[model samples]
Target: MTDTTVRSTGRLRGVLDRIAEARRGDSSESLAAVFLLIATLLALLWANSPWGWTYEAFWHTHISFTVGGTGIDLDLQHWVNDGLMALFFFVIGLEVKRELAIGELRDRSQAMVPLTAAIAGLALPAVLFLLLNPSGPEASAWGVVISTDTAFLLGALAVIGPGKAERLRIFLLTLAVADDVGALAVIALVYTDELHWIPLVVAILGLAAVWQLRRLRVWRGGGYLVVSLITWVALHESGVHATLAGVLIALLLPVYPPKRREVEWAAELTKRFRQSPNPEYARTARLGLDRAVSVNERLMRLYQPYTAFIIVPLFALANAGVALTGETLLAAATSPLTWGIVLGLVVGKFLGITGSTALLRRKLPPGLTMSQVAGGAALSGIGFTISLFIVDLALTDDEALADQARIGVLVASVLAALLGAVVFKVAPAPEGPSMELLRPVDPRRDHVRGPVDAPLTIVEYADFECPFCGKATGSMRQVREHFGDRLRYVFRHFPLDEYHPDARQAAEFAEAAAEQGRFWEAHDHLFAHADALDRDGLDAHAAALGLDVERLEEDLRDGDTANRVADDDIDARTSDLPGTPTFFLGVTGQTPTRLEGPHDAATLIAMLERMATAASPEAPRS
Candidate 1:
């Protein structure tokens, strides 16, 4: 090739790389929603095409698996809805487990706002859906409008939501969890066929087996899979929704925060892998890393991609293929079933969530505005997945009625997206005020650890004697242990003189130890024994750490060390930091940005990784 051709190829490759990198910036929900939208459109297109009969022929095809007439059989559509969609519900169950175990739902006070909103969101929509179709077969279809398609709602938020809507997203996600729970209960209780007593008993036994397996600390994936399969088959045989088996199994999976010891073991393995680049070491490190997170989180990461990108979309293709004939459209135009679903979803969801939010305004997490809440509530009406899922179950005997219900779902979802966009446009969330650190990380002045020239820096303003700081130090320590030499950690003294009289002296002691090149040693010792920070106690700690007590005494006798500790306090006061254990993070050599909310090690490392990826030279500007 000529030089011009080679140059053009290079430019094209660069553009492609940037495009891929930019796509990485999109949330999982956004990608899932995009795929679901494509499938919905394709299904509609295929169903209306000249070969429309083939669409029905394709999904109606039988698929069976048997071991001497013992296994089950289902059509392509039933397989997608019952078999593949189980994985989707399984991922949801994992999320629910994690949240109840350690996330926002664990805190009753913190969870009440979203929980109430979700309850309202659930009840009002069903009530509205029932009001119009009060006496007919359509009234049972109330479950259709009671759920919000979380992926679509989140995708719409990503597209047209206010900038920095993480808080709003979190609020909505919490609400959606309750929505999912309510929907699943309705499916199990309100939509089951005739029960088979023996199979139901066996299903109960399977659930017990799952719970026992969890309690016994079963580590093998295959063991869980076999038992879960047995439970699912039994449930299906019992005339129950087999998808509920996913929930039963997942709810039994243990979910918990990574203990410090677990993280340390992973860090040790990672360090060994780094030192010796061997397959054995690498595998060991990977296993250790996997073990640090709970089984629930691991399974979610494993299955969520398949559920979001493939299974759910295929379900849409099988279920969403409704031909809108002129006669059908005219009938649906005046159908109360159609209007009930639309109003129940689009209007009911907005009023319920927003109204609940209004009642619990004071209980909301800080930084959430009414506009953001309203927008999120509007988006919650996009009830696509479960709406259509319920349509099939509720109107099993009437294909035409099911199609009308599907029409309502599709219409409500589109309108909800549009309505959310408009609400977000008209009442946008307020932009956050700038929060940059007053003092940048300085190698000469700050107590820096790891590589001093590391690309990422996290500066912490902590009081040595504060119990809160002691707890925060553990998280920071885990972060340091994980990142190793890739990140720099800076410690600044922000001793609250009024609260802890000895805190200032503790800071001076740490600075004095710095003069002897043992600052970090003293720092760790101080926090480990924060309950005892008097002069005699600190002197004992210095002696234990082999620091020169004479030199420490000499430094404390003087004002220079005191002045150095005071400098950090001045920076904290001017920075408007509320108290000790405040954290700021950014790229090295830039003003660090203050961290808000809980500063868990996992969250911190993830945030830093994103920052590093964006700042890397190879990642071209998009």
Candidate 2:
């Protein structure tokens, strides 16, 4: 049998592998969702059942310990909330970092709509709650409504059936991250307890230990965990919420190159091998490769299991459980915390997202259409998990008030999920996955490759029928003229069929030209005369570009290009270029920056010159 089959039947058997396989499944989100629903239902059942005594005792049972003449006391629930919840926050921190670095939030324009919507969604609720409960101590927890529960929201979306673009998921995720930033800010500024010196000193020492361990290149995951636990205890005693300790420690932890020097050496070796002249040079690069493999094996052993199967799900189980009762529901409706959260989530989120998005379409760089913005904002109110946690933290002293907030979250979140589902279900489905269009196809193969020799690569996301895209061709040609051999231009379709009916067909015709090595020629011809982009114009453009007439006609009849065009539109959302003619400038060393809309030749040349000079080794002093 093969080693892969042997491993499948290995000594540890299938437990870890099963967990890995489960994670790989798309249904993992659905499972987490089922867990959430079960947890919530169990909380209600436990609260009202004859075994309610057991439930209360289970959560309320206290544990205590003494160290250095100081005593620490906590109930089982507090341990779970203060200790286990910190790990959840750390994972969230990781997700936030990943998104900002390489995921959806990497592009400024891509992030604008969601970021703006999150702000508006947050502001309206807090303002409404504050106005409703002005002087009440319970009103401090208004931040609860500001968060979007990514798992629950996305899971709800998944149930609506397939054919949805990944861009829709990505757009919602960006908004959720924006919501998380808002929530974290609220916790740091508004929810912290008063500082205490003695515990603070201990907390700082714990943090110092973690930093030193990391600096010394320690890759032992257990060491970090032990330090994180100690640090959490110190922070809890130091007057800050213990959960925030996880957030603080996670911020301090380095996620770049691993501690093993061999790993770094292996990466450098890989790069060198890719650039090397001789195949023998690459063949000889084995010892470094072996060392890198060993280091990765060790690192994975230390961290993977604890993070996936334990931390994330345990946080969901503990935090998701909230008592639901008639009393709780009634109190939630009347309480300022409840109404503010409910209205803020339901009314405020939809309005703010839809409104600011509409304004952006008119004034700012470009924005998602009214239909898409409306659908996304409507879904923003699915704030169950995080909202519940904030409510629990916000009214730690008043059990009654906290219960009311939970009721509000349940009602509002359910309403939002239903409404958002209907909106997306009714919204028109585009032709294909949006990613295929954003990432270019290869010339000889069935894929798209970026420019090979140009010093600076300019990738354009365009729709043939888009007037703005039509106007941008001249600007791009001017860039090529100014830079000569220094610039390469790449094209990807981003048709907005919601408003432009002919956009999809126009994109297909361009792809047909691509098959004949006349993509650029057909691109210019079609855009230069967009008003005549119908069947007759497409045929003339094809003939003008010297493409085989019969093949082009046959391909257009098949309509197979729709999926490629649709995929590009979805992928473009992650880059924050929700509209046409969104230009990305990629170079050897510098970061990728997008140039939006139709700029004049002079503006384009100046920007290109700046980018080109920035990539140079010895350019300027000032």
Top candidate by lDDT:
1
TM-score for candidate 2: 0.61
Query: What would you estimate as the lDDT of candidate 1?
Result: 0.82
- What TM-score goes with each of the models? 0.68, 0.61
Q: How many Å off is the CA of 370 in candidate 1?
A: 1.5
- Kindly list the per-residue Cα lDDT of model 1 for residues 184-277, writing each as its tens digit: 9999999997899899999999999988988887754677899889899999999999999998789999875444355556666766766688
Can you give the lDDT of residue 178 in candidate 2? 81
Native-vs-model 2 lDDT?
Answer: 0.66
Q: Rate the local accuracy (lDDT) of all candidates.
A: 0.82, 0.66
**Model 2 residue 135 lDDT score:** 72
In order, what is each prediction's RMSD in angstroms? 16.2, 16.1
Compare the candidates by TM-score and give the number of the best one.
Answer: 1
**Model 2 error, position 303 (Å):** 6.6
